[model samples]
Target chain A: MTIRKIDIFRTGLRTFFIQSLWNYESLLAYGIAFSILPILIKLYSKRDIIRKGREYLSYFNSQPYLAAFILGMLIKLEEDAVENSINNNSKISSVKASYMGPLAAMGDSFFWWCLKPATLIITIFLVMYFNDFSNALFLLSFFLIFFNAFHLYYRFGSISFGYKYGEDGLKFFQKFNMNLFQKVMFQITFFLLGISITMLVLKFPFPKLVENIEIFKHIEFQIFYGISVIFLFFIYKLKRSPLLLILTTLIIIFIFSFLKEKNLVFLRIN
Target chain B: MIFKVLLAGLISGLFQLDQTGAFQFMLSRSIISSTILGWVLGSIIGQPELGLRYGFLFGIFFDLIWLFRLPIGASTPPDYQIGSSVAISSLILGISFFNPKFIYIYVFICLVMGFVSGYIGAWFDVIIRRLNINISRMSRYYWNKGKFLKFKSLMLLGLFNSFVKAFLITIVFLFLILILNPILNFIFENIPGFIVEGFAIVIFFIPALGLIVVINHIIKESTWKVLGLGIVTGAIIFSYLKDFHVFGFLIILFFCIIIWVNVLKKEKV
Candidate 1:
């Protein structure tokens, strides 16, 4: 008997909720088991159902998006088991173990670290660039669509492709070179950050730096840029939380600006 | 106000679920979550643009602050979704009653509140995860007993728990904000102009902090060459073109896309 496309689609949909039961002990174990239950019920006899389902109850975790690939592979294995009357439980578990860690790592670096922040910086630049708030909303939608398109591709692709390729699906992912993708994304993010910072400085020049509007006009950019770098260094090197640094800076700025407003003798602002 | 609070709570519940429960769609992201919160609250009060602006601002700000933190495993990052919800809802609700001239004060306070609320929300998140262990166990027990219905219910129960947790938190935070709104208004109104101006300054510089935070994440010795080249190119372009320079923006954006396509082409090769 062939596993229908609708069954795969159903499994794909279920994969979205696979992490719904995420807990400290078994992590994604229950969710994973739940996701494959429908497929298991359809494929296995009642007597073998419990035994087959028990395999997924063990601790299992993976990047949520990549879980689809693992599930697809599991379904394919289950299908083969049903066809050949062979228990592939051990193979399924091993396959899951093999893919979960690496996929999680790649997904974290690529999806979370690279794709997300890269798109975010671009969206932010657009948001800041466009004065119209509706345009900002449009950009936000673009950010969502752009990010999720890759996500759903991996998800839908993983399920279908993993089923098609079975264990060899790993080779398909190997072709992508996620590290290079991450590097390129980081480069784009860095480039966009540079533009974003320049635009930010242009938008909100330091009040003190802009004190002399005529003479210090061009110099303000350089000074603000230097200040941003210094802040970046402190953020990078500081052992404490960056949130602390931000709060402290806010306090200091509050004091300075307040004193300047009050026209204090020593720390007075023109 | 009741309608707005209820709506905020509902979406906050869904967004919270989006973060960890049903769908990991980027809906829970600060950029989207906060904007949705802002838009909803803004529309309720007949101020869609105001909602979008502040929502977008808060989303961008919070997203930058927490951009580098990844949920690689069981680790929970600060819950920016709830934070933005509380913050944006409070701002929109607060602005509804207060003088618009004093909007800067509201933005400043709400931002700080949002930042603080994220940590609070995360604290709750850790507790929720801990509590979910019982649900997981029960679901397993039911599954083992061949009570698939009970097992499914337990699965949904976990999601429901997450939703209720988020909804209650949002409602509670918004309630506190509503109660304190008048007091906050009076206090800020009585405060001298200089202090308010200082907060305005802080708000202006806040984006710089966010920009630097993100830049720091990408800045490394290995990537500095590309980064430096980008900075130079960006600097030249920004210096020449002024605000809303769509033409110049498009050119640089186009160049970035070309490089991206080139990289993909190389990958295909």
Candidate 2:
């Protein structure tokens, strides 16, 4: 029997909640199982239902956006199993394992690394600089909308393409260039940070730094660029998490205040 | 006491812990959680305005710091909810009203606690995942027995366990703060006044760390020259138009965009 549009749509919806049962043992294997449960139930007899469910319980993992590919392939494979057309159940696992790593890497780079950082930087900048809650909210709302919208598109795109290509959808993904998009974003993020660092330094009114405004004026732009260079080199060598690095800076300040100054207590600022 | 603990538990569990039922739509975020606690605590203390003000600031500030982390698969990001919750609760407790200046120390202490809690939260997830995997096993068992209801409930147990774990962690942390307040205050009081003044300075620089992460992620040795040249040109344009700051920034921004367009378009060609 052919898979219905309703089944395909329902399977797509199921992809959202697959992580509800996410466990370390099988990673997202259970979520994958749950997503395909409807298809398995419809295609298999009651006796074969448990067997099919157990099949998905094997070690399976991937980032959520690309999960549509796996779900699409599962639907096609289940249909074949139902018809007694293929006995090689290992084919499903092999295809899943093969495609899982690359898709996950792509998802991580695109969604987590590039898109999230950019959205967050914009939202944070709005909140910090403008001091306007509504502005940040507006940007965040637009970001959330755009982020989820693309994922939904990927869902539909992955399923349709996965169904059309069957196992070779893996090959289809290879033909698609995630790197070109990544490179463009990489440049944008780099450029934005340079601008943000300059703005941050210029706007901040440091008492000591302000006293030397005449001097800072001459080298103010250079100082901004200098900090950017220092920061880049520091991170390059340290390879420490950014938060941890900031925490260390905080620690250094705390210690410096006590050690460098005559005493722990100093004159209070208004 | 129970009410506050329960409230923290409910919000944290709903937002960060469970991450299901679409409830996370508003709860999991630092902004919402901090504002909720700030607003609620203010009402309890009859200082709603101040509570709301600090709550939003803290939320936004931490959200900036939390930007770099993205929870992918088994690699959970650090928990901002823990930090926000701890910060709000402690700030609302009474320190802000005391000297106002003393809140700086509390901010430092609470944030440190929050960071530790976040790591613990990640560890707790590992434990929760282990427990949930057993539910999957149990569901498989029930499925074998043809007990479909049992299978369904067993599957749902995983979701329930996440809530329970989140709820417990929040409650315990709340109480831990209450129990440890004396010790925390002692440490706070002992901290040097110079350090206290320096903290405000440190907070401003913290965002620099975030910018570094973004740039570090993007930098490739191959593109360094172009990246350097583009920014230097933008800054030169800004320096030339220094009188009107806004115009200078915009012109620089426009210059960057033009360069970006040219660069990308050239790549296309």
Candidate 3:
């Protein structure tokens, strides 16, 4: 069964609608669409690639919600290759299959898992703090609109770029140095998470007093920060595994829990 | 419309319990609840405003109960059906009698119901996970197949789980409604003050665990320094401005952009 462009678009749209019904599980449907549609689309149009690409772009641009739905559906679509190969003995290139999983993971973890959640959390906090219910509604609307817009633009861009650049796009990403991007994002997220943790621990009744405090007044904050610093120092100086640091922190927390229970030297307050 | 709203609410109630295995964080959002409920109950009932208000308020109350991780088992303390029923009932009352004042009563009923529903849901989880060995076996078998059958089975399981949870919650809510006045009087007569404070402390700590996890993930040296800088900058801006939403985000974003542009640009040069 040869796959036409209309078939691809319709399949993508149907998958998107079905996935939207469930929310988080929608990503699985999305991943399926991206994988199967591309393979199917490739078989139909060998010559009019540019024209087909333009048509796809226009279709997506005209329907932002449809675009977002398709992008989300692509999340589960990549798994099709793995399932098909295992079940039907169909061959998918190791490189293609291997890269797609990590790429999906990166997209899922970074954008959906981290960024979206963090944004929503922050927005909720802001709304609650300010008592701006209308603003909260606005923020929710903004998220839906913004994400859909990006999904629409990027879905077309990725497929078109993939078709036009072919192996070059794949090779470019394979060889591309993401260390700088990784380092910057890592630092920013780390900093935000740290400050959030400290503030949460402090939970200071008076904002003025927290503001006046020259340094970390909350002992719990100081303890966690100090432990984090020690872990960081060890990583830099001794080149220890990150897992070691995580284990050490957990151990310290456990010990702290016991110490507080035992009343071992200024551990408990009131 | 009433039937659809009931179906959606029942599904939502069950979804909250995670009984359905069909968890969508977005659907659980207060805005989505309001929008969906408003759409369903608005046109037919001619009470869109009430639906919007109660749907959101009840949703948030539901979320809060889940967030607090209240220990209510065997005997229902608070639950979602109570909230949904109260909200829906009040909306019905207001529309039928043309009395908007009933909305306040609706809100209070919903709050109490939310507490009850959450407890019942938790209890249901404990009960089902213990007793439903066949469900677990089915879940595992389908999970391994990686086929359409697996997906279909999971979806069916989700639907069944949700239906069961909703039915259980509805029963609990109905039971509570029958004994509401007496229970309220008993609570007013009995529970200690210090216990309330202890509950408050537990609630405070629950949300902090999420922050702790995020913090624990960033224990690297360079990241720590950057974090320190970000906090100091955030604090300073917050001190001057009082509201630091945009400022805090921009400061962090700017710091990141500068570091990345300098490092990558230098390497390129």
lDDT score, residue A135, model 2? 47
Which is the leading candidate under DockQ?
Answer: 1
Predicted candidate 1 versus true structure: per-residue lDDT over A1-270, tens digit per residue: 779999999989988888787878888888888888888888876667777666888889888888888999998999998899887878987998898998888777778878888888878877766656657667788888989898888888888989988978877677667777776687677777776666655543323212233322344334633574466457545743657656765665566566666666654334
Error of 2 at B268 (Å): 3.0
Q: DockQ for each of the predicted structures, in order?
A: 0.52, 0.37, 0.13
Clashing pairs in 2: none
Question: Tens digit of lDDT per residue, candidate 2, span A187-239?
Answer: 65556556565545554322221223333343433353355447544854577
Global Cα RMSD, each model: 3.8, 5.3, 13.1
lDDT of 1 at A254: 69
lDDT of each: 0.76, 0.63, 0.41
lDDT of 3 by residue, B1-269 (tens): 34543554564564343322332234434334433454356445775554544454444334332322222112222334334443443343234432232323333344445444555665665554343344433433443343334434443553465456655565445444444645543553353432322222222222333344334443565566766775676556545655665665576568767766765675688
Looking at model 2, residue B74 earns an lDDT score of 68
Alpha-carbon runs more than 4 Å astray in model 1: A175-177, A204-229, A232-236, A259-270, B97-101, B257-269
- For B1-269, candidate 2 gives per-residue lDDT tens digits of 56766776676666664243222233455655666677677677787655655565556546555556666666666667766666666667645334455565665666666666666776777777788788878767777775656765665677777677667766777778777777766776787776765555444444555566555655688667655664565456445654565665476567557756876797889
Docking class of 2: acceptable
Q: Give me the candidate number with maximum TM-score.
A: 1
In angstroms, how far off is B107's CA in candidate 3? 14
State which candidate, 2 or 3, has the greater DockQ.
Answer: 2
